[model samples]
Every structure is written in structure tokens, then in C-alpha cells.
Target: MKRTLTILSLTTSFALALGACNQESPKQQQEVSAPAQTVEKPESAEVVQDTIKKSIPSEATGRIGDASIKITYHSPGVRERVVWGGLVPYDQVWVTGAHKATTVEFDRDLIIAGKSVGPGKYALFTIPGRDEWTVILNKNWDQHLADEYDQKEDILRTKVKPYSLEHPQERLKYRVEDGGEAEAGIRISWEKIGIRLPVAGK
Candidate 1:
């Protein structure tokens, strides 16, 4: 009876070891399977505000004797801002308009305020003052504002008096008027003031 009890106890211990080997642990089973892949998403882009300069193109054509004269420029609005002695300053070179420089083209040789200017395209620049203003005709017709303007390139410089306007003009304007037989006027009007430059064909 003692020998039979020993054989049965040994068999029970052998069966428990076999069962534990057959069943895998939870951690071991996870390692045997394939790993999951992770994907990253793209981020959204930010929006920015656009800052654009808004200006309008203006053109004026008139006759100086037999010669045809043309003036082209960009017009800027007052927008309730102070024009002379404030936004434009007292005595500094101005572009005379917004954006690009104002251009005047003459088909023939002309005399501006007793100064002779050849027949070509010229950029119009100005120095605004309370009483008088200096107008310039530069050889560099294609330029941005007055940043690259050189006083040495000026073909003609004339001084004229500023005229007070009865009715205010909201936007800047240029007009080529026929004064008489040999005389013509180039008028620049903006806000509450105006200036006229005399030109004669030669």
C-alpha cells in the first residue's frame, strides 16, 4: 500500500507541470502577435491678412498749339486726412501722386516757366508749401514714388503759387488747360487747394 501511494503522488505532480507548460501567459501571447502601426496627421495652415495699396490711374490729354500733350498719373484719395503742411509736409520732395511717379509726355519741345524742356516723358515731382510750391520734371520717368528721385536729373524746376479751392476735391486730379494762343496750364487739384504750372510750346 505504501508503494502504490508514492506512484500516484508522483503522477499528480507530473500532470500539473504539463498543464502549466501548455497554457501561455497573457504577456507572452501579445509579444507573439504583430505590432500595430501608428500614423501621424498633418496640421492645418494659418491664414494671414493681405495688405494691398489701392490707387487709380488718371490720364489727361490736350493740345499745346500743334503739339499734342499727355499727362498720366495715379490718383490718391484725401480720406479726410490733412493734405498740405501735414500729411504731405511743408518743404520736401513729393511724388505728386500715389504709387508710381506722375508722368508728363510732350510731343514737341516746350518751355515750362521760362525753362526749356525737350520733347520726352518726364516724372513730375513737387515740394508743397503753404504759399509756394516747386514743381520738377525729372528724366527718370519710371520710378517708385520719390525715393529714387535725384535733383540732378531734373530737366526743369518751376515755382508756382498755391490757390485755395472753393469746393474741396475728394480725389487728386490733373488737368491740361488751354490758357490762350501760346500759353497752356497744367493744373493739379487735391483736397482744398490747387496749383497751376504754365507751359508754352517752342
Candidate 2:
């Protein structure tokens, strides 16, 4: 009778241990399977291209004397259409940016061609001519709508030298360089047009 009771107890303990192991096995399997299902997909090449396409026009800054000027231009696309008397006509105003109007700023009042121009933000425009071109600075700030341009609103107008280009400019660009005293020239160039606006810092 004693032997039979011991054998029965051992059998019950083994069955309970087996049941516990079976219950824990399912939880272990669930933990291992979850990471496989939650794996992330890699980004496609098309998605990366779209991100670059949306960010076209970019900006760069330059310092000339006490003045800090921001140069903004259009990044590639449809820029080849920029031509004199076709897209940008002779003796007409053009916003120096492709999408929005480009701007130049001065910390204090500056002079251009012996004309007193106040310190503030201005929209840069140019009137292309054969020998000389006119650089215009308007008090307007915003650019994309194209309606802010007003001829009578011009703050300063000055004649700049126009030079013939040896090679075609693929994109329009502008830069501010250091000039002696408080002065600098704002250069505008694209394909055939090269003009400069001399700003006296002193």
C-alpha cells in the first residue's frame, strides 16, 4: 500500500510540471513572434526624390561691411526660359527670385550712385539695357503673389554696368562683396545679363 501511494504522488507531480511548462511555452512563442510582425519597411527611392523636389529655392547669406544681406535664388527647373524681351523684357522690373521676390538688407542708410537710400529691406529688380541696366529697390517685402510690385513704390533706382557673358549662366545668382569703407556691390547675373548695384556703406 505504501509503495502504491508513493508512485501515485510522483505521477501527479510530473503531470503538474508538464502542465506548467505547456502554459509557459505559448507566452514565450508570442514574445518571439511579436518582433517579426512589427518590422519596419525601408524607405523607397521615389520617396527620397519627392522630398528633394519640394525643396527647390534655397538661401545663402553674405556680409559686406556693417550690412548683412541674404541671397535667395531658385534651384533648377524652367530657369532656362529666362531671356531678355521674352520672359524678362528690356526696361521692365523683375523680382530677383524665381518663386518669391529676393531681398537685400542694410543696417543703416546707404548710398547708390550718390543717391541717399535709407536702411531697410528692399525687393531687388533689374531693367536690362544694351549698354547699361537699371537696378531697382522697392520697399515691398513679400514676393510669390506677384501683385506687390508697384512702379511708383520704388525706393531707389541706379544705373549699373552691363557686361556681355562669355558663357551662358544656367541659373540666376546674386552676391554681396566687401568694398572699402562702408560700401559693396550687389551683383546680379543670369545667362546674358550681368549687372551690379553699388551700395556705399559710409
Candidate 3:
């Protein structure tokens, strides 16, 4: 009987030890799993953005006397490339801007370089030169990059001298400057060059 009792006690002690080990294993697993729940994920690739446009739509509008002048064009950056006499060849007609032909709109009758022009929208083209630049106004304002430009459709053509600017202009820009009274100046500036056209109420 003693031997049988000893065997029963041994069996109960072994079962109790095994039960303690099993309970400790679950606690260990919980501790390991709790740390995993608190771990943070990496966020290196979630905060990047893109911001660049090749050709941007730009506008210059101002009123001189009773005439309202508006110029719409696509402004392109210099981007460290050659401008005059290289990208823009001398004596060749250029759209004066990028993508589409630069357009000028007049709300009232005006005189451009002493030539009378009625109120209308016209495409502005230029033949860039080192000393002189030819500015042309065409009747066909709705065109793409001077691809459909025709000399026969030209309304007025005038020569203007290109001047150097003190500071460089990174992007092409056009501005309508009020020249007092019934006069305004149309200025195109890019790189280090400046071209101006004088206009007055007619």
C-alpha cells in the first residue's frame, strides 16, 4: 500500500510541475506578442511629392487709358540652355512663347508702333536677332507653335532693338506697363534680353 501511495504522490507531483511549465509558456508568449503589438512601422516612403511643369500658362493684362491689353502665352524656363542665336535662330519666325502662339488682345482701338490696329486678338511672332528683332502681328491667333503661321496673314510688322537686362530672367515673361496718359509699353523679357513695343490709344 505504501508503494502504491508513493507512486500516486509521484504522479501528482509530475502533473503539477508540467501544469506550472505550461502556464509559464503562455505568459512568455503573451510578453513576446505584446511587444510586437507596440512595434511601429517605418514611414520613409510616404511623404514625397512631385512639382514640375514643362510649360506653364502665363498671362499679362493691364489697362492703358480706355484700351485694355491682354497677353496670354506659355512660359518656358531657360534651364541652362542657349536662348538667342541658338535655340531661337536669328531671322526665323518664332511663336514668341512655348507650345502655342503668343496672343495679344485689345479691347479698344490702339496704335502699335504708329500703325493703327482695330480691337482684336492677334498672334504675336518674332524674328530674333542680335541687334534687331522683328515683331509681327498676325490675324490668325488660334494656332499651335507657329506651325500654321503665314506671312500673308500678317497685319503689322515692326522692328525693335533688343536690350540687355541687368539681371537674368529665368522664365519668359510679358508685361504691359502703363506709359502714362493714353500710352502703354509691351515688354517681353527672357534670359538677359528685353524687347519692348510701344502702343497708344487711337
Candidate 4:
């Protein structure tokens, strides 16, 4: 009788332990499966290519003297288009960017062409020519393209010589060359052409 009682107690304990293990096994399996479901899918190649084909909203900035010079615009690519004389005409006012007029902002007063320009945002317009390009800073920085361009609203205009690039630039880019604390340059480059606008911080 004693031996039977002991055997029955051992059997009961073994069954309870087995039940507890079974319950915990399913929970462990669920935890393992959850991570698989949460695995993220990689972006498709077509989606990546689409983004590259579109015009990129771009910005470039620099520090000269006490101000932060900022350039904001959409960068368009040169997909084998004749940029200088075809897509972008020669001698007409261009927005200097694809969608909207490019904006140039100086957080502090700066001098361009020996004239003091108050610290503010201005629409950057350009007249592209074979030999010379006219760079204009207009008061209205809110217009699209050159549609609402009023030369009467121009704050500053300067003619700069255009030079040929040894290597073609695939995308339109603006660069602020930091000459020093007193003098600097703003350079525009696209489709094998380059223009430099001299600026002074003194």
C-alpha cells in the first residue's frame, strides 16, 4: 500500500511538470514567430530608381563672416538635354532652379558688387548667355519660375563671365566658396558651364 501511494504521487508530479512545460513551449513559439512577422521588406530597385529620376529638393549653405549664407532650390539633372542653348534659353531670365526661383539668404549684411545688401531672402535669377551670365537678386522671392519676374523689383544685378567646365556636371549645383572672412564667392555649375558671383563681407 505504501509503495502504491508513493508511485501515484510521483506520477502526479510528473504530469503537472509536463503540463507546465507544454504551456510555456507554445508561448516561446509565439515569441519566436513574432519576430519573423515583424521582419521588414527591403525597398525595391524600381522605387529607388524612381526617386533618382525625379528632381531633388536641394539646399546648400556656407558661413562667411558673421552670417550663414543659404541656397534653397530644386536640383534638376541633365539627362542628355542641351542645357545652355536649348532647354535653358540664352538671355532670358531663368528661375535658376527647376520648380521655383532659387532663394539666397544672408543672415547678416553682405556686399555684392561693392553694394551693401541688407540681410534678407532674395530670389536668385539668372540670364544665361554664351559668354556672359547676368545674376540678379530680386526682392520677390516667392514667385514660381520667371513668370512673375519684374526687373523693376530687382535689388541687385551683376554680369559675370561664364566659363567651360572640363567635366560635365550631371546636376545643377550651387557652391559657396569660402575665400575668407572678408571675401567669398558663389558659384553655379551645370552642364559644363560655370559662373562665379563675387561677394564681400567687409
TM-score on alpha carbons, each prediction: 0.71, 0.62, 0.73, 0.73
Strongest candidate by lDDT: 3
Candidate 2 TM-score, true structure as reference: 0.62
RMSD of 3: 9.1
Residue 120 accuracy (lDDT) in model 4: 94
Question: RMSDs, each prediction?
Answer: 16.4, 9.0, 9.1, 7.4
lDDT of 4 by residue, 1-202 (tens): 9999999999999999999999999899999998666664454223433236667899999977777899999988888778888989998999988888899999888888678999999999999988888999999999888899999999999999999888988889999877885458898999899998998785
User: Candidate 1: how large is its RMSD?
Assistant: 16.4
lDDT of 3 by residue, 1-202 (tens): 9999999999999999999999899899999898666664464336543234486899999976689999999998787789888878888999999999999998899888999899999999999988999999999999999899999999999999999999998889999988887447899999999999988876
lDDT for residue 1 in candidate 1, whole number 0-100: 94
Least accurate stretch of 10 residues (summed lDDT) in model 1? 34-43
lDDT of each: 0.84, 0.69, 0.90, 0.88
Clashes of each: 0, 2, 0, 0
lDDT of 1 by residue, 16-131 (tens): 88877666665566665524211122333345532333567889899776668899998877776787888788899999998899999988887788887778999999999988
**Which ten contiguous residues of candidate 4 have the minimum total lDDT?**
42-51
What's the TM for model 3? 0.73
Rank by lDDT, descending?
3, 4, 1, 2
Minimal lDDT window, size 10, model 2: 44-53
List candidate 2 stretches off by more than 4 Å. Answer: 1-55, 75-82, 181-183
Q: Which parts of model 4 are misplaced by more than 4 Å?
A: 1-51, 181-183
Could you tell me the lDDT of residue 3 within candidate 2? 100
